[model samples]
Target: MIHPQIPLILTALLFSAFFSGMEMAFMAASKLQLELQEKQNSLTGRIITHFSTRKARLTATLLIGNVFALVLFGIGMARSLYPILTAYLPASWQYPAVFIIIQTLVTAILALTVAEFIPRSLFMIRANTMLNVLAVPLLISYYILYPVVFLVVGAIRLVVVKLLKMEFSEEKPVFGLTDVDQFMKKSLYQHETEKVPEVDARIFHNALEFRTVKVRECMVPRTEIEAIEISEPINALRQAFVQTGHSKILVYQETIDNVVGYCHQLAMFQKPTDISSILTPIIAVPETMLASELFVKFVAEHRSIALVVDEFGGTSGLVTTEDLLEEIIGEINDEFDEESLLEQELQPGIYLFSARQEIDYLNDKYNLALPVGDYETLGGLILEMHGDIPNEGTIIQAPPFTITVLSMDENRINTVQLVRQAELTAED
Candidate 1:
């Protein structure tokens, strides 16, 4: 026959586990997910939303419930064990102090492992689901224990605010960047499992990371800029526009490094005789400037394009508002963008890429673990490795990768072929 103490001990342990698991589930569950559920107006959703707002009260209730359950467990355990221990132990060890020590040790071990660790871990794994499943029961317990919780929490707040001169505010943002980022990551993972498109998730991920991107990461390089000397005639500028098929052409002083401004194709209809007569001023920014900051500057200044400069104040590249936006939204291909900028996979481990492609972009798209340093583009990587401008047909060995220049002019690399030697050999 079961002892009367046995039923009390078992029930106490179950309540302890429930309270402990609910506490962890509340802390670990996503606030954004909770807010979304709250919009559904379900019973569980309403309870969770209410608890989310009064977090201190909820936390106090869980802790108080846990304490009561643990107290009951200790009482039941002591009563049940007393007779058994006294029956087995020698008389010298039957003292109250010794019995208390043994009882405390056994109770602590059982409570920590059975009531704390296991339940907390399992609940935290599917925190949102666990919260939704147990919301009603938690709410009932919350109200049942509210008076005690209110007194405990109110006393603590009073000490903290009144006696200690500490400020206290219970307000919390409904959601934060971290919440959105985690939500996006979870959605992406779900999309992968469901084999659904993840374009929206990818864009959200990019926007979150946009703050860290620098101007040099997105700008068209200096080598690719098309410009005419400021002293050049209007006809020469008009011819440049026709040849490059670009609506706007930059105007430089004596060299491209001394870029003055840009001239628009529509300015030609006004019959401007000189390049200076139609030059529209462009902003210049440092290469190290954050893309997000630059975007704010662009909007505030009512400008769309800016020239990026290095530390020495020389022109580094050109960045348009479209380019800045593309950092978050992906590529925006206008008519001016080169249609033939090569990017293709010829085979499993072989690829053809435009030399202008950013190293980070290549690494992310193709899983190329290429080393990143002071350089940005594929051509820059080749230059850093080879220590010189490579000619057409030139082969460069950057371990794990064999880069061969497919096409280049005297100044800049245009296209290249890359073979991942290790990947190919492994497959073979």
Candidate 2:
């Protein structure tokens, strides 16, 4: 037969678990998810939104409720266990100190495992779901414990302001990057299961990651820049504009490193005789500058093109507003842009790629899991490993991948064929 105290202990444990699980669920639930739900006018969403807005009060309520439940649990546990221990244990174990030690160990083990760990773990796994399921109950609990929570919070604020002389502000933005990022991750996971579309998820992921992208990662390298000497004749500039098919041609003083300005193809209509007459000043920026920062600068300055320079102030590459925009919305090609970069999978796990293809792009698209370092592109990776420009048809081993130089110019690699070793082994 079960003792009356047994039911009391179980009830206390259940209440304790509820408070602990609700607290974990509230903390782990994505704010963006909650915001979206709230927009839909759902009851659970409204309740969660209300509680989330008063986060301090909600947290205080949970803690206070948990303390009360734990106290009841301790009393019930002591009452139920004292009789069993006294009946079964030796005479020496009946001492108050010894019984207290044993009771603490048993209570701690039961409280931590059943009422804390299990519920918190399960609640955190499906936090939004748990919150939605328990929203009504949590709302009732919030009101029931509001007075206690209010006093506790007021006391804390009083101590902080009067004794510690510190300012306390609970103001937080409704949503942040972390909330949006978590929502995107969930969308991507759903996409994998064919439950949602991936396009928006990928775009959001790119936008969130755009802040960390450096100018050098997206800029057109110096070797690929189409520029002419500033001292050159106006006819020479026109010829360059026609041959390169570039609207804006950079103007250099003595060498490409000393870029003075640029001449727009539209300037040709003015019938300028010298290159300097039509030259428009171009802004120079460090290659290490963040792409997002560059975008802000461009918008503020009302400029489109910027020359990316190395630490020595020598020209490293060139970037435009379009390039920065591509970091988020993805590649945007105008009529003047090249057809496309060479990206072709010849066979299973074997492919041809332009040396200019970014390492991150290939790794993401093909799941190549290629090693990344200071380099940004396939050519850069090859150069880093080989330490010199390899002639065409030169085979370079880069573990799990065997890269063959398919084409090259006097200075830079143009294209390469990559073969995955694991695929070849499986075929064999």
**Lowest summed lDDT over 10 consecutive residues: which window, candidate 2?**
190-199
Clashes of each: 0, 0
Best by TM-score: 1
- lDDT of each residue in 125-162, candidate 2, tens digit only: 99989999999998898789888988999998899899
Per-residue lDDT of model 1, residues 1-428, tens digit only: 99999998998999999999999988788877788778867788778888878767877888999999999999999998899899998998899999999999999999999999999999999998899999989988988998899899999899989999997655556568998798778776683446433248878988999989999888888888888999988899999988999888888998888989998899999999899999999889999999999999999999888999999999998988899999998889964468766899999899999998889889989999989998888999999999988889999999889999999887789899999998899889
Q: Which residue pairs collide, candidate 1? A: none
For candidate 1, give the lDDT of residue 159.
90
Number of the top lDDT candidate: 2
In model 1, what is the error at residue 290, expressed in angstroms? 0.6
- The number of clashing residue pairs in model 2 is 0
- Point out where model 2 deviates above 4 Å: 1-11, 74-110, 194-199
